[model samples]
Target: VSDSGLGFSHNRFIALIVSIAFLVVLFEGASELGGGMIKAQVEQTTSKFHPEKNAEDRLKPAMVLATEANIDNSVEETSEAVAAEWSAEGSCQQVIEGNDMLQFNLKEMVVSANCKEVTVTLKHTGAMPANVMGHNWVLTNNTDFMPVAQAGGAAGIENNYVPVGDQRVLAATTIIGGGQETSVTFSIDSLVVGDDYTFFCSFPGHYAIMKGAFKVI
Candidate 1:
């Protein structure tokens, strides 16, 4: 005998509900995918504009980040790991070498995840004096780097070319001459993992070539 009409109708209703739910899921997934693609495109386009390059062109106040012309400030996004990183898993202390040629030995410094506090030591390896070939390690978020570096130059030699009491400076080392070493100990609690950070010598004109990425992994 054929099934009851009521039973058939009930099965149809269940099937209809299932089909509708499936459609809804498919639509939601497509929307999410499309939104992600749009977001990536927007950000990519925005970076080319470099609105953060100049202080005056800013339309809104935000954490300033972007590279200006003549500066090698292009940083990889948060998802990409540094091609070369220096890190000691058990030690929170790292040393950076600066020579008279206006370059750092390492292109990227990585802080291990276990570090609650990090110590960065800047060692001057040249024979020049502080007044001529001084070097210091200054740390700041990527966008704030150039501005802070400019201010540091204006601050002059007496202040080690670092802005005094500047909140934008996450940490700074004292200026040192050849064979001299200075270090800055800072807590990594406020730093975000994978975010862009810069470390450079704030001495006049040194940041232009002595800068490198500071990564927290």
Candidate 2:
């Protein structure tokens, strides 16, 4: 009975050792798997946030954004420059007006010498008839302004208040009444740059007050 009890205890001891070995192997395998999973997760997070793997991949988007910003700024500056140039360099066509007070709206008229032909639009914003308070736009040199105006007054409204075949008259628009509009096209070849010129209304005696400097530059 003593031998049998000893054998049974030995068997139990061997079984316990086998079970312990199996448990150790299982735990080691589980640890290795968990470590591998953690390594993979860390790598994935680093690649997503810190993409310093390739220089091109990191800087391409930034470069594109900067280029677009530069292009937009260039377009805006170019537009502003073009607008300023247009405002400084007068155009070939202009408009002027005469009201009941016998005053021209523009104190000075600017003309571009580069224009082949210049057009002048005149509007009568007065409340009187042409025969009563007539207004006609006449262009002449400063030297011939008074004489041309006098001759035009003598010409009368029948001839649009402009002398017939007068060489001193550079251009003239017809006499207009209230709410009337007239325009005249004249060649720029006859205009001299830096020369003094005068534009006035030759309506009876309205030249003195209704005149302005006409400049060709």
Candidate 3:
């Protein structure tokens, strides 16, 4: 009698497994009712245990389910900070205006490493002719600035007052006469963090007076 009862229990267990497998197949075959019933049962169990978790907890699935998802947010933040470190890489946008008196309104500009390309716009607010008081924006390492400016003066207005093919020239804008404006966009890959850079007007005799610091921070 005991053996017969054991055999009956084994048969029932096999039947239960077969029933579960069949239900899984039905759910996979697009049986919405079967799938919904399974989902409802699981949700009921989840709510019973996690009754305190509300809408706010549900909104941030990644944050709330970090353990379940096995994600590390600290690493993400660190990567972002490293990317923004100006010394590693960066770019900037600067705007400077010149007047008939040969003066730049800004004495300094700052660039951040988050940018891949920087753009500079030079506006000639003065009404003077390019021959008399033309203005252009030029950038170079601070140490080479005086020499480049001297060479650029000789290079003349035809080259926008800048020495042509000068590798020291990080970026330069076109020479503009009064009431005209120009802009130049260049990569920041060559710029290093904390390096001293100087921006000046390469127009004849202007660099001596119109110059400022370019900060990469």
Candidate 4:
């Protein structure tokens, strides 16, 4: 006797549901992957030009070291460390005011190594002439500052109170007289970050009186 049955196996029904769920998941994943690939290809097609074109052009030896160059933010935040670097130096800018009293407006300066180039401006706000009370901005490691300043005294007025080719000298500005101004811009790649730095005036006996702590951050 053959028995007529119209019963659905519960296991088979559960398996069918699972298979459908798996298929749905697989298709969704593939679609997402395809969409991501398409977006990436579109972006690549749109950005055909080289990203570093300007940077490559400015990399010549005679770049003149502008103050507004592309020094990354990480370097600027860590300027003081560059003072001891001697190899990866940063650019700095300072304005020093000189009068007959032989003083600077600032006692110290902070430098950032994150700058591709640094610029320091020296302004003489007093009535004294360059021959009488000239002031110039100078930078170096704390240890080398005093010696370099002492030697710069003998360099005389013609040398702008700066010694020629001094290895210890990191950066220097031209001497400025009262109501005059000067500025210097240099690269930061010559110094390291997180090291002690000093900025001063090398005008004979000025280092002791015209100096300040240089910071990177």
Error of 2 at 15 (Å): 99
Tell me the tens digit of each residue's lDDT in model 3 across 1-217.
2344555666677888899999898878776877888899999878845747675666667666874443245334543654455342333656678899777776666777666888889999999989998999999999989999999999988888788899998999988889999999988788997999999999878998789888776
- Candidate 1 TM-score, C-alpha based: 0.60
lDDT per model vs. reference: 0.83, 0.85, 0.81, 0.73
**Backbone-clash count (model 3):** 1
RMSD of each: 20.9, 20.8, 21.1, 18.5
Error of 3 at 81 (Å): 26
lDDT of 4 by residue, 137-212 (tens): 8888889988888888899979988889998999898887789988888776767777788888887777787777
What global local distance difference test value does model 4 have?
A: 0.73
When 2 and 4 are scored with lDDT, the better candidate is 2
- Over 1-217, each residue of candidate 1 has an lDDT whose tens digit, in order, gives 4554666666677888899999999999999999999999998878757756654556434423333321334334211333444345644888878988787776778887679899988888898999999999999999999999999999999999999999999999999998898899999888998899999999999899899889888
In order of TM-score, best first, we have 1, 2, 3, 4
Off by over 4 Å in 1: 1-88
The digit string of per-residue lDDT tens for model 2 on 36-149 reads 999999988786567557668789899999988975675467546533554324557878889887877766777888988888999999989999887888999999999999
Ranking by lDDT: 2, 1, 3, 4
